[model samples]
Structure formats: C-alpha cells, structure tokens
Target: MTRSRLTPEREAELYNAVLDLLREVGYDALTMDAVAARTRSSKATLYRQWGSKPELVAMSLRHSKPVDISQIDTGSLRGDFHEMVAQSDDCQMERDTALVRGLSRAVHENDDLLQALRELFIEPEITGLDTMLQRAIARGEIAADNPALKYLSHMLVGAFVAHPLINDEPMTQDFLRDYLDAVMLPALGLPAPGV
Candidate 1:
C-alpha cells in the first residue's frame, strides 16, 4: 500500500506516541498498529516515516530532551568532584527511569537501534563531560593529561546505572558522594580535603 506523507508536527506527534507506547508496553511488545492507534495516525504513515520499529524507536530517543551540563564548577578539584557527582546523580534520577530500561532492552535487541542510541544520546553526554574536564584542566584543578578524565563518565554515571540493574538498589546521593570520595578521587590521584 502506498503511504501518505506527514507534516513535521504530525511526525513529532507520532514519535511521542511511540515513546508513550514503549513506556506502557515495553519494546518487545510494542507494535506499529498500537502506535498508529494511539496517535490517531496509520501504520502506513509510521512505515513511510520510519521503515521499522528500530528506526522509529531510535528516532524517538534521539529527539528526546538533550542533556544540559552547563552548571559544573567548584573552586577546588574536590569541590568540582562533588558538584559533578551531584549533577550526575540528578541527571540519572531525572532521565534514567523505567522508560530508559525499556529503551535499553530495545537497543539490546536491535544492533542498528543500539548504534543509533550510542551516537545520538549516549556519545553526546560523554562529549559534554569531556568538555567540562577540559575546562578543569585549563583551570589547573587537574593535570592536563590526567587518566581520571578518561574514566570520569563511566565512574560517575555507569556505576550508578549498573548497580540498580545488577543489584536492585536505588542510587542515592549519599552513595554517590561516598563513592566519589573513596574511589574516584583517589583514582584521579587527588585526595579529598583534610585527608
């Protein structure tokens, strides 16, 4: 069947409907028919805009809110680490909810979706963190070539995300702060203040 063309706004509405469907039904059970019904659109329209489930899901994730790393600076390295931990904690709490778990499952099932998500959502956040580290280096809070900078993103965000998925405990600010002080700070060759 020939597919009808959609306006940009209609496309965005359909994409949001896909996200809502994913949240409600999960990736494995999500269907184009359900999405079309929810958005009051048609299966042909979804197919015309995005050829498959992976493509549609990937596009929805890509258009989701972008991360903002604009507020990160505390006079000393320890302070900066604390601020970063707080920022990461807040970001995780804000964005990495059950919906993300659904998206994660989708990506796991589809290689193309996985690649698109990494390129669109994950990489940019890492790049923004890298830029923040560069600023710290310029301010001499950290060595220009510190190895810790290489591991910062994973240490700050990855561990938190993994713990709940692996062990089922919610990540709290207290745990994050303690982790930064005991593990991350030392790994970077920096000591917490008064230590």
Candidate 2:
C-alpha cells in the first residue's frame, strides 16, 4: 500500500503517539479511536494512511529503529557489528525491549499483526543484515556458505528476547558488544576482539 505523504515530522509524531498508546494500553486493547484521539488525527485519516491497527503498529515499530544495519561498513565484520551496537543508546534499548516484550504475546495471537510486522519491520531488517553479511563474505571475513549465516537471524532475535529473560537485565550496548565478540563472531569464524 502506498503511504500518504505526510511531512516527516508529522509522521514521526503519529508514530510516537501510536507507540505511546500501544505501551499504555497494550496491542489487544489499542484502538484506532484511541490513536486518533492521541494524535489529534481522524480515524479516517489513520485508516487511509495505514489501513489497520496492525499496520500502524508495525510501521511505528519500524520508525523507531535506532540504526540501519546495511549502512555500516567498517571494513571488517566485527567493526560493523560493534558500530551497530554503539549507535544504540542503553535507555532507548531498554524501552524498545520492553515494547517488543509487550507486543510479543499479541503478535503471536494476531495473524494480521504478525504479517504486518514481517512485511513492515522484520523483512527489511533481515535484508539489511543480509547485506552486511554479504559484504563480510565478499571481504573474506566469513565464508559465503558458512552454516552460521543460516541461523544468524534466529540467534540475534533469541539474544534480544533471551537476554532480559535469562539475565534479568536490559540488552545494553555493552552486552551486545560482548555477545558479538563472544558468540556471534566466533560462530561466523571471525577472530575474537584483541586476538
């Protein structure tokens, strides 16, 4: 669907309002009326722009992403990964982690939301990550056929969800940097930091 061309500032405002409502009410209880009220936009305008709550929520999540993984090219996979982690702020990561955790149950139950998320958020992220990995392969940093590439996305997502659950701590930049150095880089056959 072609999105309505709102000004970037207006679009960001709407996305922020949607995310705030989602945080306050949860996905199951969030409504277009609530979003309209919060953003001072009409229900028709929201529907015209996004088509549904699922799409709106998905787009909002996409808008809130801190870094574009595809753009990082530090001449080495390790540097690229570390740069990606460094671009994210610890407090913002905590908030985003909490938001995703809240949406997780709703995403599982709502097929529309799941599809929207896959289309609007997950696929683009995967494509960017694939680009980064492909660059690494071309640079001889990792084998193109490395089996680790197959499970990379799963491992990353599992790390995001599992960190808070297992460690009872927010997924900070430091933790992500450590994870890349200890787990992901090793799996992809990259040398450990300082080695």
Candidate 3:
C-alpha cells in the first residue's frame, strides 16, 4: 500500500476491499474515502491510479471476474451451457444475485458505471455464448438466424435476474439446471438432455 508502487498482493487486497465494500454498501453508497480506509491506501493514490470511483470499481470487477470464453467449449451447445451452470460455485449464486440486484438501480442511472459493467461483465459472456450459438449453427444443429439466438443472453441471465421478482424462491444450481433443460433447451429447439 505504498504511494508510488503496489505489489501484486497489495493490488489484490485493494480490489477485494473495493468488491467487499461494494457488496456491503452497494455502488451508490460506497465512497472513495471508504475504499481508501479499507485498503489502507491514500485517497490521492486511488485518485492518481484510477481517476474515479467508477473506474476503480470497474477495474476491480475486470480484475476479479476475468472473462474466459475459451474454457466454455464443451463440443456441443447443450454441454457448454450445462458446463457453465455446473461449474459455477454452488454457494455463489445467492451472493452473485445480491450483487446484481444491488447494482441494478445504480447501473441504470450512471452511464459510466453501466458502460463499464457492460464491457467488463455483461458483453464478454454474451459474446462468448453468441459464439457458441454460431458454432452450433455452423454444425447445422441450430438453424442460421434462429430467433432464439437473438435472445439467448436475456433468456439465460433473466432466469436468474428475474426469479425473485417473479417468485419468492431464490435461483439455486438445481433450479438453473432444471430451467435450462426445461425452458432454454426447448426454446432453442434442442433435444432434451441425455437424449
């Protein structure tokens, strides 16, 4: 936590501090002073390094939840989607949902934060899934220009995002698997799992 240089461990500590504060206070209520105090870094250092709160938060997100589209290729579209859900940390769903819900209001109101979120978190996954769909189309399993392809991101993410609003139940790993098999696969005109 030096003024001019940050070791790798120190940087990670700072990022974790930012993410933890974000979870605790949400984006709107979080402040640079809080981040500085939590990370034991000076406010001037944060400003000099990141320039603003949104940028710092964005960098924190990008550094922490890096996009890795390459790991998702399971040879078939169904397998890929299944792997995506299966690989998710079982306990993380609730925390992830809370973070999403907490950021929901602020993301809409702040263009900078929204743009950063889209670039860092949203679009990478969407683009990766879109690539997977295109691969299916090339294999002739999915028809080219299928309407379902257009809404794939919403279809997958909305299940998690809208679950609480639609019902009292939280989206669990089992629920995601069931929803994928029942709703998503069918919507894409894919055969049922294990068929």
Candidate 4:
C-alpha cells in the first residue's frame, strides 16, 4: 500500500487522535466516522490515505512508538537488546502494553485488523528482529544454528505479555533489561551480561 500523503504534523495529529479513541473505546467500538470527526478530516480522505479503519489503527500504533526496532544497531546483539529495552520509558511502556492488550482481543475477531497488523506492524518488527539475529550470527556472538534463534521473537514478545499476566504489573525497561541479560542471552548460548 502507498504511504499516507498527509504532512508529518497532520499525520501525527491524526495518529494521536486514533490512539486516544482506541484507548477510550477500543478497536471494536472505534469507527471511521468517529475518527473522521475526531481528526476533523473527512472519511473519504482517511480512507483514501489509510484505506480502512484497521489499517488506520495499525498505522497509528506503528507511528506511536518513538523508535523503530529495525533501525537499532549497536554493533552487538547484547547492545542491540539493551538499546531496545532502553528505547521506551516506564510510563510509555505501560501505555503501549495496555494498548496492545486491548488490541489483542479485537485482532482475533477481525481478520482485517489482523492482516493490517501483520502487514503494517508485526511483519516489519519480525523482519527487523531477523536482521538483528543475522547480525549476531555474523559477528560470531551466537552460532548460526543455535536452536534458540528460532524462538527469540517468541521469548521477547512473551516477556511483554507474561509480565503483566504473571506479575500483575506492566513490564518495565528495567525488567526487560534484566530479562535480556538473564534469559535471552543464556538461551542464545551467549554469556550473561557483564561476563
């Protein structure tokens, strides 16, 4: 799909409005009309730019993050992981976690949203992670055939969901930093942090 033509400031305004609506009413309840009204743009323009509500929501979520995981390169897998954890502050992580949790239920029931998320958000993230892993393999930080490479994304994503579910608190940067040091590194057959 072609990218949105809206100016950066206008696009940010629209994305923020969409996120606010998502927070207030969730994906199921959010409507194109509401987004149009909220952003003060006609529905046609929104559809023209984003194609649909699911795409709009997915795009909004992709835009909300301050960093793109794909672009982080710290010259080592460990450094890259640390950079990822350090990208978001505690409060932003909490909000983003809650937003994702809210979208999870909706994604299951809506095929469009799922596809949109995969195309606009999830797939890019997976690709970025794959690149990061490839770099690790090239640097000899982890063996190319390390079994844990296959499950790395699952482990990281699990860290996000499992923390709130198991610990009853949103996962923070500190928690993720420790998780990378203790779990992810060891699983990849690398020494623990500071070793």
TM-score of each: 0.68, 0.96, 0.86, 0.95
Candidate 3 local distance difference test against the native: 0.79
Clash count list over all predictions? 0, 0, 0, 0
| lDDT tens readout by residue for model 2, 1-195 | 566568889999999998888878899999999999888889998999999999999999999987788998999899998898888799988888888888999989999999999999999999999999999999888999889998988988888899999999999999888998999999999878888
Cα lDDT tens digits for candidate 4, 20-76 = 998889999999999999989999998888989999999998898788777888999
Flag regions of model 2 displaced more than 4 Å: none
- Which ten contiguous residues of candidate 2 have the minimum total lDDT? 1-10
Is 1 or 4 the stronger prediction by TM-score?
A: 4
lDDT of 1 at 63: 60
Error of 4 at 112 (Å): 0.8
Q: How many backbone clashes does candidate 4 have?
A: 0
Consecutive 10-residue window with the lowest summed lDDT within model 3: 62-71
- Residue 10: error of model 1 in Å? 7.4
The model with the greatest lDDT is 2
| Highest-TM-score candidate | 2
Candidate 2 CA-lDDT value: 0.91
TM-score of 2: 0.96
Ranking of predictions according to lDDT? 2, 4, 3, 1
1-195 in candidate 3: lDDT tens per residue? 233587778888998898889899999999999999988779998988777788788778766653365467778877777777766665667767777788889989999898878876777777777787887778777788667878878887798888867887667888888888888877888877777
